[model samples]
Target: MAMSVIRTKRGMVKPAKETPLTTLDLSVMDRLPVLRCNARTLHVFRHGPEATRVIREALSLALVPYYPLAGRLIESKPRCLQIECSGEGVWYVEASADCTLHSVNFFDDVQSIPYDDLLPDHIPENEHVDPLVQMQVTKFGCGGFVIGLMFCHSICDGLGAAQFLNAVGELARGLNKPTIEPAWHRDFFPPQEAEAEAQPNLKLLGPPPMPDYQLQHANIDMPMDQIKQLKSSFEQVTGQTCSAFEIVAAKFWSSRTRAIDLDPNTQLKLVFFANCRNLLNPPLPKGFYGNCFFPVTITASCEFLRDATIIEVVKVIQEAKGELPLEFGKYLKGECVSGGEDPFAPPLTYTTLFISEWGRLGFNHVDYRWGPPVHVVPIQGSSIIPVGIVGSLPLPNKGIRLMTWCVKEEHKLPFLDHMHGAMDQEPL
Candidate 1:
């Protein structure tokens, strides 16, 4: 079902009330070289068009508390970014599509629909001054609508963005204010300070860390039963329980090594993010929105993985994951830099896979008077999908789906076969 989306209007949406005209400090995580980018998402609602006026008006009211979003991201000194709370407002766009949700099967076939069109425009000239947040609402012929959001990664992580959108939803329901007011205690983290000087050669996060080599790929929806059997088998042999992310990631590494047929001595790096919000003594505030996830990386040689059992791979990942608390502590103290900020970070290669846990991030619940979204999709326009990131998303049947990106077209089917074949491989 081919479709077209036309933009009807576009403008800035300022806060409903006057906001403070002062600069807001940033968290250490916010200043990390890895976090300075935009995160885009699409929320599809099954019901009608109260969204045009309801969301626009509610967004204004929601901005009073999340005013930093309306501000511009500026260099407070040099590499450090601070929010200039000028209350300029967020970018809003109104659009309509020529098809229905049923026509596209509610984006079950995501490739057919241009998820990019649902996102806000990228204005290079206005990059520095434009709103840290940009939103677009596209209405379908069936009265259903899609809300596309582009949030500055420096301002918050995926969970934090969901919190802000939840606030907007509350206001849309006629609530006077958000259930949990936004807090700006970024002063808790002094600028990268010592850590900043250590990595003077690190590049910013928005641009591809590696440009010349890019992987064109698709999403592979791994069935829940497959994941379950894999997880159960690992624990049965190792007698150690691991997360769905852990087991799946381990198998993914092993399978890719076989599919790509990398050199026996080729070093394989698996990078995944661990949420640091609760790792601290006193966890960050409920509304203390900022970047709080750090990448945890594990490297192994293809020869070892080729001969290793699924249990061995799982144990390797579990060991690396256990270092989060220590690494996160060093990061905040500016003693060490996260992988993304490390000038000597591991070189991304065909064997490297970045796993991001996108399952249950609450984007599916971003209500706007209508019920929760039927589907929440992540859109990667010009943004780099580093090394075919394998992300976990919820399947309606209470199952887990792995949206694996980066496997070359030629190796697609074989990569998927290796993906599922891991379950059948007997340990040598």
Candidate 2:
């Protein structure tokens, strides 16, 4: 496939009038908030000869269901709406037939991608901490191409977006239609009211107004072989069944807190997310939307923090995995109302945040009539710096293939060193 550059003006790729839905149902907060977000980009690629046919067929079968994604975010009288029923919300672009399908790119020179680009950027600039979701697909002069995916933390958590992308891929590949339909059930999970409060244990922290915090980011490409080796080493060294995620997380968290002179007496919490699909009393259908998942915290006291071995930290995180239940969800909802805080508010005792992409089962499949993406990355978010670890099988070469990112300046050396050390350690 030959590669080349094509720069169309900003609005050139805009979808047709009939392309978007007109009368959207934005009664749900999730659907409404999407309106307030306006991050956009252009994906460039070498139009594949075969890609044209593939996309046409894929669109025929996939368009009906996937069409909703094309709608644009719009503000209505009372709230924001995804606005598609009358046909105005989705985004789409096509490569010329003569171009190699693999040679595609996404352009985003207009604005510095915001930390919550994937989500709505409603917060003021002074409060921003994470980068927005803004990705560009670039086709190198060589036949190679890459896909960039940016996201804001407010919209969908990592796993939630992955679920949506996976559905798109299924449609593209002519696989099973997405069994779990998306349900904007945000009405059921409103911000908590203070009178409905119970425990005041959950702490919420906001970024300092106009605070100066250096930001940094890293992308680690680990093949499966290295990942397996790292996992095995972690277990041997820790005498625990360390998952790639747990091991890496332990390394980053320990290093960051240690470097920042985290107070010994201060309670440290590792906030990891848990997908509550099967944990619900009656499992939520695959399509049920809204925030069905919640954070599961592993707490460490000053004493525990100062004296515990790396293995202990891993164990604490591992054990906390068992705490996800339907009641916990209800507890979180009630806590939100009584606390008068956003659901994404910083945890009272949260010191480190870990989001593991170790078992992201469906990312590679989002065909969309075009071929699969070469890469996918999450943009940063506010208040909390997140460490994401993506797991991939070993490549034909030597090491494991993994993808990781952190708040650049805050994490760089410590995060990298910890990952290197953890990867080098032998599992118990």
lDDT of 1 by residue, 125-174 (tens): 74345778989999999999988888999998888898899999999988
Best by the TM-score measure: 1
lDDT per residue (tens digit) for residues 1-428 in model 2:
23333422111112223443454443233432322443231223332334333433443343345344433344564444433433222222222222433232222211232223222223345632222232333334434333344433334444555566556456656776665566543334334532233335545455544434544555454555665665666577767677766665665566555544456777666666666656655665666433445566666665675455667777877777754564356554554332343433445323555655534645544555556543333333333355555544322233333443344465567656755654455233
Q: In every candidate, how many clashes are there? A: 1, 93
Query: Which 10 residues in a row give candidate 2 its minimum summed lDDT?
Result: 7-16
On lDDT, the candidate that comes out on top is 1
- Which residue ranges in model 1 land beyond 4 Å of their true spot? 122-129, 190-214, 336-345, 381-395, 423-428
